[model samples]
Target: MSTYKLRQGRTMKSPLVNLAVRRLAIALVTLLIVAFAIFFATQMLPGDVAEILLGQAATPEAVAGLRQAMHLDQPAFLRFIYWLGNLFTGDLGTSYVNNMPIAELIGGRLMNSLKLAGVTALISVPIALTLGITAAIMRGTFYDRLVSILTISVISVPEFMVATMAVIVFAVYLGWLPALSMANEVTSITGLLKAFAMPVITLSFVISAQMIRMTRAAVIETLDTPYIEMALLKGASRSRMVIRHALPNALGPIVNAVALSLSYLLGGVIIVETIFNYPGIAKLMLDAVATRDLPLIQACAMIFCLAYLLLITIADLVAIVSNPRLR
Candidate 1:
């Protein structure tokens, strides 16, 4: 009997493991496709790297020599092959403009971006989740209506617009925070606040608004299920019913909502970082574009894509594992 039960447990676990493996494989394939697309897209950008680097006074012969030296004289396909091969070996190559190794150049910038994203997430998640759950618990009340209206309003505005307003209100008019974030100058607690303040606020407002809406939807959907209703009918307090019965079952959807909303940061941070002049990977990529630095651009693009894929893959795994049927 014990052996039969052990066999049954293994049988139930195998499908989930298989699904996880499949998901990982799909993510890898998707990443490859995305990398291919990113590589070719950058290749199509107008302007020659050799010309851009050499300036207008450069002779044709000089440009040809520079191209040859940089291996830009090679066919696009061969260059792409070489780039992709290096990518698998963790070699991001050197920047055309900076003439520095891409990894070394972007290391601090990537950390800055991560810091911004992390602080924004830390501030936004709990507030958004609390508001979402509260709004779900108070559905149809004036408070619920108010929360809904506010979240929708915030969501309707673009991040750049939001960032602009934040700069104006906080920096230009009030003069409370700096117009631009000087991340390198941070030293004391106050300096840290001054550095991260405006960017974090801009990012948080946008991220939280989306999270609140989705979290509310997920919770409310769970609340309407039959089991929750039955729990309430059996004298379980509404709060208790939701906290105990509804929330646990709603975990899958809630996690998915969080993941989807956070994914917005990948795109939104670009605008935020640019607006505030924050020293981050997005800003690095933008500068790289102006100089037609393909290696740097490709690396930044892949980092964003890989991060997005990771978030989505983790969310999928959580949802799969949380499913009662799968259990």
Candidate 2:
């Protein structure tokens, strides 16, 4: 009997392991497709790297020499092969303008973006969840209506517009926080909070709105189930019924929503970062594009794509674990 039980355990575990491997393989294929798309898209952009580097007055001979030196004269297919090889070896290539290593340029910028995303998520998720759960609990009440109206309103506004208004209200008019976040300003924890204040708020408000709506919907659906109704009749208080019965069942969708929101927060901070002059990956990519730095652009875009893919895979795994039918 013990041997049979051990066999059953292994049987169940093996499928999960196999599923994870399959998902990883799919993610790798998706990344390869995305890398190819990025490479070609940048290659198609209407400017010459050689001309950008040498200025408009450069002679054709000089431009030809520069393109040759930069390996831009190679056929697109051959260049892609070379780039892919370097990518596997962690060589993201050098910048066209400054000639700096791509990895060195993005290293600090990537960390800055991660820090911003982390702080925004830390501040946003709990509050959004709480508000959503509360709105669910108080459905049809004035409070619930208020929360719904507010979240909907925020959702209707664009991030850049919200960011502009936040700056006007908080930094320009009130002068309570700095208008622009500077690296040196974030020396201490308090300083970090203050520096991150505007950008974080700008990002969190937009992100949390979606979370609130999704959470409310999921919780409300769970509350309507027969199990919750029976629990209520069995002397379960509202809080007790929600905590013990409804929440557990509602968790699958909530986890999926959180994961989706987190992924958005990671990649969707571009407008917010641009508006506030935050020195994050988004800003780095924007500057790279302005200068037609193809290698750096490719690296930045590839990083974002990979991050988004990983987040989605994690969400899928979490959803499957929360509701085993997905397996």
Candidate 3:
């Protein structure tokens, strides 16, 4: 009997390891594809980097010399191979406009974006889960309907519009927070939080709306399960029943929903960041595009894609661990 249990443990462990290895392999392959796509897209972008750098009135000979100097004369395939080799060796190449290394350009901006997402998640997740669970517990009541209506209403508004409205109300009308996040650099904790206030709220409201709906659905389904019904019949207090049974059962799906929202935050904050002039990966990508900075653009795009893949992979692992059935 002990041997059988040991064998069962080994079998279960093997699959989990295999799952993790498979996910890692997929992530690597997807990153390669993203690299290729970003490179090609940048190559195809209109306007010549050399000309843009040298100006329109520059002689054709000067332009040709600059192009050759930048190795822009090389075929697209060769350039991609060279770039890919450098990427694997930890060199992200240099910008065409300023000649600054891509790594240095993106380092701080990426951290700023991460900080923004973190603050937004901290504010959003608990409230969203509470509202969702409350709605589920009061599933057929007026409170449930009210929560449903509120979340749906928030979801209906586009992020940029929501951001605009928040700036108008909180910055212009209320004079509480800064309208622009450009100078909201994080020198100190208080300054950081104050600078992040409007952007965090704007992002949280939009992100939390989807989470609220998903959490409500997940918890409601869990509540209807046999275990929950049995707990109720055993006269388990309402709070205890939900806290111990329903919430645990519902946690897997809630985590997945939050992960999905986090992935969105990582890559989908372009408009919000742009509107507020916030320094972040999305904003850096925008600047790269505007300047036709091929190397910088590719680096930022690859980073965003990798972040998204990582988040989903983490969500899958968490779900498997939280739900024994997945094992």
Residue lDDT tens for model 1, 134-172? 999899999999999999999999998998899889989
- Compose the digit string of candidate 3's lDDT tens values, residues 1-327: 999999999998887777778877887898888888989988889999989989999999999999999899999999999999998999998987778888888888888898888889889999988898899999989999999999999989989899999999999999888888853456887777668887888899898989889999989899989989999999999999999998877778988888888887765488889988898889989998999888888998888888888888888777767775656
In terms of lDDT, which candidate is stronger, 1 or 3? 1
1 versus 2: better TM-score goes to:
1
Over 4 Å off, model 1: none
lDDT, model 1: 0.92
Using TM-score as the measure, the top candidate is: 1
Q: Lowest lDDT 10-mer window, candidate 2?
A: 318-327
In lDDT terms, which candidate is top?
1
Taking the tens digit of each residue's C-alpha lDDT, what string does model 2 give over 1-327?
A: 999999988987777777777877898899999999999999999989899889999999999999999999999999999999999999999988778999999999999998999899999999999999999999999999999999999999989899999999999899888878785457798788777899999989998999999999999998998889999889999889998888877887898778787777865699988888899999999998999999999999999998889888887666556654443
Each prediction's number of clashing residue pairs? 0, 0, 0
Off by over 4 Å in 3: 183-190
Candidate 3 pairs with clashing backbones: none
User: Please, what is the TM-score per model?
Assistant: 0.97, 0.92, 0.92
